[model samples]
Target: MELNSAKPGLLCSLEASQSQRTMYPYVTGTSVVALKYKDGILMAADMGGSYGSTLRYKSVERMKPIGKHCLIGASGEISDFQEVLRYLDELTLNDKMCDDGNSLGPKEIHSYLTRVMYNRRNKFDPLWNSLVLGGVKNGQTYLGMVTMIGVNFEDNHIATGFGNHLARPILRDEWREDLSFEDGVKLLEKCMRVLLYRDRSAVNKLQIANITEEGVTISQPYSLRTFWGFSAFINPTPGAQ
Candidate 1:
């Protein structure tokens, strides 16, 4: 009894769990938008991180390339997203070390992440992020989402967080399987512009990532051009007074 009490295995475990669990996200992002195009998958997200109602950081890059086949965008806690990336880093490193010439693909990465998120939820300590993963493999374009609690699904177009509320409707109205690269970009911009207008947490500065048969290309950070000349913008309730 003394030795077992000295180890304090259960106590140590409880402490570790408490340390890692996030009851709520502190620094968070707003939305992620992605879709399929003629050549590949395109993903976009802004660079802002909000703490409660305050915009705390303005240069957080929430999209990253996974292995050689996936582009991942995340919305929600920035630190949790970074930890998830570290998990992928270890996973990819191990895959390469195998030296079997078989690398992990987009589907595999997505599945692994789904399991990770689910497991974390089962532990009652979720990652507090919504993830959008997109890729092109063997001429097949893939786009999917996994929420913070691990609900996952595939779709022709995907938007997370505020994008799900404000941007997906636009995607549903206009997305197509045969969209050209230029058209796809224009479509994403349209969605993002709406999020910027409606989602107070969203910022104009953002990055776009493209993953294709050739490889992944993440654009340098840039801002979208917006117009505020609409009547509603000039005065929201013109006659309320």
Candidate 2:
């Protein structure tokens, strides 16, 4: 039998596939929480990204804006979320060129993401993330979530990854149709506290954001402290026994 020579097209195809595979990483983030309030929306996520069983990072920001008006809180595949945010930025900028000359609103951005997730699902290569979209829609504040496979749903509150398991219940208990912005912020802090206690992947260092018709406001990181504990030993063990 005679051997067939390698074709340039086949080599090019293989190289292209290998390059894509190499570019994608397996790091994943966890625990994103979001809720809608009377004024707007509040969202938060912990700062941990885990690679398998190892905790890989402690300062990842999982909350960001899509365009100027929409906020997204994401869990899973930090790099993928960054790419999606970039895509959203470009998409919104492109939409500004329409005859209407308007950037993508929150609902429009959510629809775009749904399509992107579905298209990736059809390709059997997914973004491997869950995202919360929060902002104003039709003069009203809106909160919604998109799953890895493109399922999108609206809710008074939403949680993803570890937060779904540990923080959602606490949110559900306090969530109300009439919750004010201050109440929403307090609720989100409480939710983070619950996750910090229950979810091993979560910590006291939290990133919280609020989006409204006015704009987005993110809180600075603050320590969750204990008033009484072993820390009393800093100066001297108080009756060490």
Candidate 3:
């Protein structure tokens, strides 16, 4: 009777393992940064994927154009991120085939992705990524973020992963609504430089994309200028053999 509720070992009862009930990411990217300037939105991400503590992929492209006006950037499981892109690709294709001339905007794409990530989490299987969506539609700029848990918010500027920790502070102090495209890029570079110096998972090679009323343009991968003359970086063992 009450023995059914007893401990498993005493009754020789075999308990099933809950190993597959959750998700754990293997290869993951670090962070993504997005901001809104006068003309439109801008985003940046580095090309690096880490396996545990080991560096795995170095040329991964985390920021991508969605539809015609929006750009999406992700920081997390690289494979899962790619799967999200496939979903968007299909969605965009379907919209094109409909010939409605009404494409999915940044807000719409972000909302759709939020649903996807949340649904997967509810199933005990999550995508393990933080996403940034940016675009310019109807002469208005949009910037938003969604986490693996489906948490989301919009702001003039948004960043994911390490960017949230190390870059947001800088952005909060510097980002402005009417920032020029040149200034926006410089600001993003400042944040990325800090990340490159502080975040071990971050790489120096990065891509910056901007979406104006015209369209989206992602820059070629480039590295930032770094100085290692500081004492902390110069010598860990000043007098040691």
Candidate 4:
């Protein structure tokens, strides 16, 4: 997979500020969380794109299924994530053309993505996104993550960006290897809710994807239920904007 240049107009900088240094992301998404359940893998991400402190885009689809079995959830530059999808789609097509019974699963896709990220980093131009790859094949489930710098790892549960900061602690305390599908979705929803409440780049609307031996299932966009009745939310300091 090759890294593409950031999309024109993807960044929300003033025209006067445009320069080589401005090629990096100015609008970005937040966290993505994925975990393994007894049946397979489940992932979730909010639909938000933030430009600096401004909420820029809504209804952006950050989680998508790759080929038939693998699903990917991405956070960071929305343009970079879209570019990564194009690369992965081509890779999967070539693999399909090989006519081999075996295809790239979650593990293989994760490896390919990490190499792409690392290669781009070596060129001093990274993809500017973090990804969660999840899938199940031959009764084995895989859940892994990779960052812009190419750091990669697998866990029963994994999250990127703010999720790494706010969600992983809850996962560490509550995640289980043999979690049921219901429990897994509940856990992910819990994580997403926390992110929506605490992460400024996060939104209440989210999409969840699941991959089992049967194949991939991506849910329609939805919003999480929230309560903002806390004292701090109800009352701010005098003269506070």
**Model 2, runs deviating above 4 Å:** 1-25, 99-101, 226-241
lDDT of 4 by residue, 109-202 (tens): 9999999999988888789999889999889999999999999999889999988989999999999888988898899999999888788888
Question: So what's the TM-score on candidate 2?
Answer: 0.82
Query: Which pairs clash in the backbone of model 1?
Result: none
Greater-lDDT candidate between 2 and 3: 3
Relative to the true structure, candidate 4 has a C-alpha RMSD (angstroms) of 7.0
lDDT for every model? 0.90, 0.79, 0.88, 0.88
Q: Write the per-residue lDDT of candidate 3 for residues 78-186, one digit (tens) a residue.
A: 8889888999999999989999878888889989989998998888788889989998888878888899889999998888888888999999999988899899999
Q: Candidate 3 has what TM-score?
A: 0.87
Model 2 lDDT tens row, 1-241 = 2224667777777678776421454777878888887778888887877776587787888888776688988888888888788888788767776649566778777888899998887787888789889887557877788898999988889999877877888887778978987788788888777677656677567778989887888887665642333444355666764
Worst 10 residues of 4 by lDDT: 1-10
Which ranges in model 3 have alpha carbons more than 4 Å from their true place? 1-22, 235-241
lDDT of 1 by residue, 189-238 (tens): 99999999988999999988888998999999999999999878887896
- Per-model TM-score, in order, reads 0.90, 0.82, 0.87, 0.87
Scored by TM-score, the top model is: 1
| Model 4 misplaced regions, further than 4 Å | 1-22, 236-241
Count of clashes, each model: 0, 0, 0, 0
State the local distance difference test value for candidate 4: 0.88
Candidate 2: lDDT of 241?
A: 40
Q: Which has the higher lDDT value, candidate number 1 or candidate number 4?
A: 1
